[model samples]
Target: MLDDIDFKDYKKKDDIHGTVLYPAVMVAPVQKKILKDIISKNKIVSIFDPFHGSGTALYEAFEISPEIHLVGCDINPLANLITRVKLQGVSQFIFRDIKKIEDYIKKPDGIYEYSFPNIKKWFRPDITDSLALLRTAIMDITSDRNRLYFWYILLDVIRFNSNTRSSTYKLHIKENDKIESMQNTVIDMFLSAAKMNVNKFKHKSDNFILYKNDIFDIIKHFRKNTFDISITSPPYGENATTVPYGQFSMLSLYTIPEYDLELEGWELDNYSIIDNRSMGGSEKSISLTDFELSLIKDYLSLISIRKQKKVIRYFKDYFYFLRELCRVTKKYVVLTLGNRTVDRIEINLVEITKKFLEKNGYKNISSVMRNIPRKRTPRVTSNVYQKPVNSMNYEYVLIYEKNNVTPDREFS
Candidate 1:
C-alpha cells in the first residue's frame, strides 16, 4: 500500500481536470486530485483509457501535462463524441455562433410531428418537440466535429430536464412526478452546458484523439510499448444493471447516419484485432471461452440468483476485456476501481486486478486508498460483497509496473 505517500499542495485550478455534471459520469474532483498527484510523478509521453467513460481521465491527463498525447477508446459512440468535442472541437467562437443559430431559428410551430414512443412515455409532448427541434438544428451544421460538440451539450440537457431523481448515468428515475415545463428545462440545460464547454477549452491545442470502437480493436492498431501510461476505470462489474448506458445516450449517438447501429452490442464480437467483447443489451448470442466460462460460473454461484445473469455475463466480458488491455500497455497501468455485489456475494475488484497483473508478468508496486465522501448510497453489506461505504470499505488506486519486457515475444 502507498498509504504513507503524501500529496504535495497544488492549486485546485491547476490540479483539477475538466468538470462534468450532466449524465454524471466523470470522477469526483477530489478523486481527480489524488489521481493527479500520482500522475505528476512521471513524464508520460502518451496515455490511453480503455473505458473512457465521459473522457474524465483523459481530460485530467491533459490538465496534468498539456504536451502529453492522449488516446481514448470506448464502445459507446456518444461517449466518444463527447470526448472529441471536449478535446478537439470545443472553442469560444463555436458556442457564440451556436447561440446566434439558435436565436435565428425561432421555434417553429407544429415541429412536434415526429415522435418516439419511448421518449413520449417519459417526457411531455412539448419537451419532446423542443428536443427534436434542437436535434435537427445540430445536424444541420457543416462541420462534423462542430455538429458533434453541439449535440454533446444538447444531449446533456435530456436528463437534466427529466423529473428523474438521479442523473442519466443511472436509469432509475423518481416515479409518478411531472415537471411543469420540459421545453424550458431542456433549453436552459443546453445553453448552460454549451457555455461551460466553451469556457473550459478556450485555450486547448489539438493533440487528443477519440476512438469509437471496442477497447480491444482500438489497442490492436497501436504498436507494442506505444503508450507510457495506461490510466483508466473499467466498468464496475454487472452493477451496471442499475443503468443502461446505451439506451440513455442512443438519442444523441445516432444523430448521424454514418455511425453503425451494429455498434450497440459491440462487446460481443471477437474483433481479435481489437481485443474486447460487446456489452450491449442485444448481445445474447455472443460466446465465452473456458476460462471466462469458469469465472462466469463462479460469479453466478456467488450471486446465486437468476435475476442477475445478464450482468454476470457482462462482468465476464469485462474481465476478459482487461486481459486484452494489459497486452497493449507499456510500462505503467493504473486502475481506479471499486467492489460490488451480485446475487449477494461480494467481488473484490482491486484484488482481481492485482491477480491479473501477477499472471501477466506485472508486479504490484503501490496502492492508494481514498475515501469517497459523497457516495450517497449505503455501503453494500452481504457475505458475497461488502460495501466500501461499510466502515470497512473504500475505493482504491492500484498501480503496477511491468516485471519483464519480452522483446522476443512482443505482440505484433
Candidate 2:
C-alpha cells in the first residue's frame, strides 16, 4: 500500500554517479533517501547488496548505522576491489609509504609486469611497464589488506592517465592524443583517496566486509534467514548488450586484481540475462498491463528490425532473475529500479517485480518513487536531441517483505 507521493516533489538534484569501472549505473540520491527511510524502521543486523555497484548503498548504510554488518556481493572483480577499499579502512602509514614506492618506480629500470594480451592493448609500453613495477611492489608487501589498498589506488588512476575521453563507461581512446603522464598523476590521486578514506574512520569504528563472488552463488554459501535487509540496483533488461558491463570495466579490472577465472556469459545461451524497453511515453500509465502495452507500442515505434529479438530476450531474462531474488532474501527486500525504454517501448519493471514477489510468497509492503531531474548533455549526433522530449528521470524504492518465513526454517 505505497502511496503516490508527488514524483516531481521528491526529485533528486545531485549528480548521477556510476562506479569506477561500471559506467551504466544510474544512482539517484532521492532513491537512496527513500531506501534509508525504509531501513530506519528495522534493526538491520546484516545488510546485503547483491548488485553492489560503486558501494554507495553499503557506504550509506554504514555511515547511518555503525552496528549494521554490511555484506556486498558482485560478479565484477573490480567492483569487489572498490567495495573492499571503501569498507576496509587503510592506515596512514601504508598510504604515506606507498607514495615512496610509486615515486621509485618512475626511475629507470623499474621492476615488475603483467604480460596479459588485453593489458597490452590499453596501456602504452612504458606505462604498462611502470604499472607492472607498481603492481609487484604492492604485492611484495606482506599485508594482504595493504596490497589491496595499493591496488585500488593504482586502478582508480587508470582512466585519468589514459588517452580516453570518458565517452560512456567504456574506454574509447582519443586518436592522435599524447599519453598523459601516468606516474605523478596516479601516485598523487592514490595518496589523496587514501587520505580521504582514512579520515572517515578517525571518528567512527570500521566494520564492513565485501565478497568477490556472484550474488546467485553467494546466497548458497550463506546460512538461511541470515540477512535482515537486502538493497541493490540491478541491471535493466536491455542493458546486457546495449549496456555492456564487462567491456566498460575491463580496464579497471585489469588494474585491480587480474581475474584468471572464466567470465560467465550472460548473453545468447543464458535465459537469465533479460533486456527490455524503458518507460518514456507512458508517464500516465498506472497498471502493469497498461505499462506492458505502452512498452510494446513504444517498441514498435522506436527500434529497428535488428533489435526486435533483443527486446524480447531482455524481458524474459529480467523476470527469471526476479524469481531468484525472491528466493534468496530473508525478510526485507528493497529494489531501486526504473522504467527503461528500448526503441521507444517502455518497460514497467515495478509491476513485473510486484507479480513476481507475490508469486514467491512475499507482499509488496510499500514503494516510494523519486524523480531524478535530467540534464541535457551533448549528444553524439545533433538530430538525436532535436526533439523537445527526452528521457524521463525517475526511479523507485520498492519494499517487499517475506511474510511467510518461519522461525524454524532450515538453512541448507
What stretches of model 1 exceed 4 Å from their correct place? 1-43, 107-114, 143-145, 167-177, 180-183, 239-243, 254-316, 376-393, 404-412
lDDT of 1 by residue, 38-123 (tens): 45554467888877867777877776677888988877666676676666655546865687547734854333244433555455
Q: After aligning candidate 1 to the native by TM-score, how far in Å is the CA of 348 from where it should be? A: 1.1
- Model 2 agreement with the true structure over 1-412: per-residue lDDT tens digits: 3454344543222311222344434353444564566555555677888778668778667667778888887666556666665566465466555665656556634465565435555677766655666666665555555666667656657766655556555456655435544343655565565555444423232677666555545565676567777788877554443444545556655555443222444322222222212211011222233444343445545676655555555554454445556666678788877766544555667766776677666877677776554322222212223533234366676877888643232221
lDDT at 112, model 1: 22
| Candidate achieving the largest lDDT | 1
Q: All models: lDDT?
A: 0.58, 0.56
Off-target runs (Cα >4 Å) in candidate 2 are 1-36, 99-103, 106-110, 118-121, 178-184, 201-209, 220-225, 238-240, 257-308, 373-392, 404-412
Q: Tell me how far the alpha carbon of residue 256 in candidate 1 is from the true structure, in angstroms, after superposition.
A: 7.2
Which structure among the candidates has the greatest TM-score?
1
